[model samples]
Target: MTATPRTAVVIGCGTTGTSVALALTAAGTSVALVDDDPGAVAEAAALGAGTAWTPGLPPADLVVVSTAPSAVADAVHDAQSRGLGHVYTDTAATKDIVCAEAELRGCDLKGYVPGHPLAGADAPGRDDADAARFTGRPWVVCPYETTPAWALETVDALIAACGAHRVDLAPHVHDRIAAELSHAPHLIAAAYTTRFADSSEAFLRLAGEELQAAVRTAGGDPWLWGDVLAHNAGPVADVLDRVAGELARAAAVLREGDSCAPLELAPTLQEGRRGQLALQRAGHGRTARDAPAGGRG
Candidate 1:
């Protein structure tokens, strides 16, 4: 069996950090959980995420920073500055800005690997964190060219402990993909949900699976999402522009009462369906690859 990380220091005790800590613990690792607020540390401790941080504690095998995208750079810098672990990593949603910020702030780039776990829940904090949150999920990695081999190995150990599949991508590429698969979708959900905010209860009651799916991310943390969007504005805008154009075309077709073969909306709808199928296939592949050997999944 591949050796998992034996010890880790997880900074930021929010949903992702708490989940990572719990996963690490379940894999027989000793975790030290840290947060800016005493309440957060206490909460994580109560949930058995890990013991609270103490000054001068021995450095661990790895350090995972699961702070919001806005705070990721600073958290990584602080962790490295304090000599926290053998390698430092982050679970920030956006990669480019955070990577640039870390470089601009004179972080130890060779020791830091920026990553994003493509999984989360609407609820925040340790109370809602589950160790299985990252299971069968794609975890994108943005390792600097100068990053050491040991650092990459350290992060791989942590990812293994969490039952996640690792994927390598350049920082800019990661940001672009995240904008399409995550950031822009959140913006669309928020916009869609806001349109019905003033509607009657009966209107809300009419929400079917599709409407609920469309607005699922609308319940996300706005402050955290705002920071993410501000950081990845260019990429998010690029994707949103395409979406907006398609939406306008659909509206125009509806206004002209167009329906039947080769209609304007048909192409758009077909392309959308194709993209959804691609995502479904990708998800199925991940599940199959991660499933236990000879297991009927």
Candidate 2:
């Protein structure tokens, strides 16, 4: 059966979850917000995301569990046991471990679709949540073999309601891509920003937009990021190693005497320019109106 959730429940009240609630509520879908921390739920509600969910509220058409990576499986299992919704999805960065744990916990596979919205803010609270956060973003869905067609449809409607394009991927593929695109990048930004941690105010005054841009993602909570890195360690480490090698080569080349002119770094700079151009041509980070019709695979 085709589905569009008329009423939904968002099971976490952090930035991502609150943002989802805001989008859904703005779309005229009834949204109930919940969190283990009642204060979080109240904060989201204050932002007009949705009303706080009560224990005996009717089961929603869809339930979005937007907890951190390590808590996603447990949250999903618990939501299912409570008959929270007809179809369930989690917004964790790493999919394999969450999916595996859900399976191990005997969650009803047919009614669940593993998902991640490729949009985030460094803030963990509702301060940074926005209804437009997912607009034009590539929201991924990893359908299990047992996932029912209607369940997928429900999730598609949810993504569409939030103004996002849907991309389907295998669980492992999603994790690897998350590592390359998000996890590793954040780690690299943190590494780069660490240099400034002990810098004097006068030294930091000389920093420019380029330096700020390079370390933008470094503002995220370390505990949250640490869990994400730990969960996707293997894939993230692979990307880190490749990036480290490139930086090492660049460093080694620069260490050479004046005989090695700065222009000798042309190859690496050219490669970076090409990659940036390709990313722009692909229409990444565009508004919904400017984004292309389909999501990347």
Candidate 3:
């Protein structure tokens, strides 16, 4: 952003979009917040995320989309067709479907870039939209062969503006990693939480910090997560299948309680401990690409 992009059009005033709008606005970029939900638009505007959108507005310098996975392709196509911005990008979790949809629709690819941010809000909607939500987060950018340098830079500008780090990855590799990192974990959380969903208060009293923390993602929108799961079904299913195998093996060992059962579980327990420590260490540091600038609420 040598020119310092002045105006931005943010599509979908959801958690990511609202936060992005607020961060850009705080950085002195005039933002236009658009969403189908009138209440959400009003809420975002009230929070100073951006001005409420109206039709027939002037074209913006950039457009950042944070729409649902199923709607992402059509949204980008429409935005580009309408010349909503000089550069277009999205924060959708799954990239293959959106990119494929844009290609099928013959969308102008010169200004289009695909991205995903690793961090997530504890909840959704305007109430949970934190302008600093992207801080120190790993933001992945998947640029195709034809993706122009300027478009990639434009998105990198947004990532920098949001105080997030930029990571470049191929689309399929990003998808596979995302499945293991996010999609499978969300499903597992829901599965783990469901065991106590209808349990008696007395039975639930046994739950500990580990159980609560592990199932935190169960608090998210089920329908929205289901849509993500459907779009990335292949990779997500593969990860879940592996998880199932491990669980089955553990169950078998517990049930049989053979002489080697303790030895078999020892490696699994030790490996899990190492994984936890690795994740904790990863969280304690900042990536070189993160700008970590001043952010708005």
Candidate 4:
């Protein structure tokens, strides 16, 4: 039996929200784009994304909260209280807190999925929102056991409509991994990149593609990154401690020279190589088979 096309209401109209609305519309879902910013809503609707709205809009079949993690709980509650949607989902970067709040608020967890798209451009705003933004990228879907089967299917279908691949993860697991893979690295990049700015003009001139690429994420939206780091501070702190320990070991190895250098550095270097391989595999839509075989001198 063919299911009826659902009416999807996307709140926020930021980059992520606009993109999702476009994808849903492309998939034959009637969409209404809502945002506190009237201009943003108009821009998205101008692009044929959906109907623009300020608030107090009529209910929809699906309500997608694409706001910042901090705003997700309120958005979910508002949608639920208005009976706005049959199924609700969020595109917040952090999941654990949002999921907990949803459960606490007595929102319909059975029809809620916590989702995060693992891709975005350096720029922010609805202007940067593109249908191709999430193409071939990983979209994490964290569905609870009580999550309705229909809700899961609807969320998965929407993700696919965005041209992204879906991966199922537990909310806590997603938070931890996101901390290690994205949050910590962004923090480090923002710190390290600032150090080079005060160097001599010639020194800065000598900076190459590798250096630029390494620090690119440092240019991300500060408020967004700040919230992300704060929300996942505990897990991020654990990863940072391990990183600090490894750095100390590497420093000692360099001081000791050949006598113990290889011994101390081998594992760290190998782990890094394994991480690179895993990222490469993920990019190529392959499972992280295992650690790549190697050691370093």
TM-score of 3: 0.93
Model 4 C-alpha lDDT per residue in residues 1-297, reported as the tens digit of each score: 124337888988888898888878887888988788888888999988988654565566678899888888889888888788888889988888888888887777887888999876555666777877777678999998888788887777777777777899998999999998888888888878888867898888898989888888888788988888887888888988887888887887798777767877888889889999988877554323221333211
lDDT of 2 at 174: 92
Angstrom error of the Cα, residue 126, model 2: value is 1.6
**Candidate 1 lDDT for residue 149:** 84
Task: Compute each candidate's TM-score over C-alphas.
Answer: 0.93, 0.92, 0.93, 0.84
Q: What is the lDDT of candidate 4?
A: 0.81
Clashing residue pairs in candidate 1, if any? none
Total clashing pairs for each candidate: 0, 0, 0, 0
Tell me, what's the RMSD of every candidate?
A: 2.0, 3.1, 3.1, 5.4
The alpha-carbon deviation from the true structure for residue 199 of candidate 3, after best TM-score superposition, in angstroms, is: 1.9
Model 2: residues with Cα > 4 Å off, grouped in runs = 1-3, 120-124, 261-264, 284-297
Give the Cα lDDT of each candidate. Answer: 0.86, 0.87, 0.84, 0.81
Question: Which portions of model 3 show Cα errors greater than 4 Å?
Answer: 1-3, 287-297
After superposing all C-alphas onto the true structure, candidate 1 shows an RMSD in angstroms of 2.0
Could you tell which candidate, 1 or 4, scores higher by lDDT? 1
lDDT of 3 by residue, 1-297 (tens): 544468899999988889899889887889998898988889998999999867788888889888888888888899888889899888888877877887788778888888888775456446888788888888998887899888887787888888787899888888899899888999998988887878899977887988788788788888778888888899999999999999999999999977989898999999999998998766554443243444321
* Candidate 3 clashes between residue pairs 3 or more apart in a chain or in different chains: none
lDDT of candidate model 3 versus the reference: 0.84
Where is the poorest 10-residue window by lDDT in model 4? 288-297
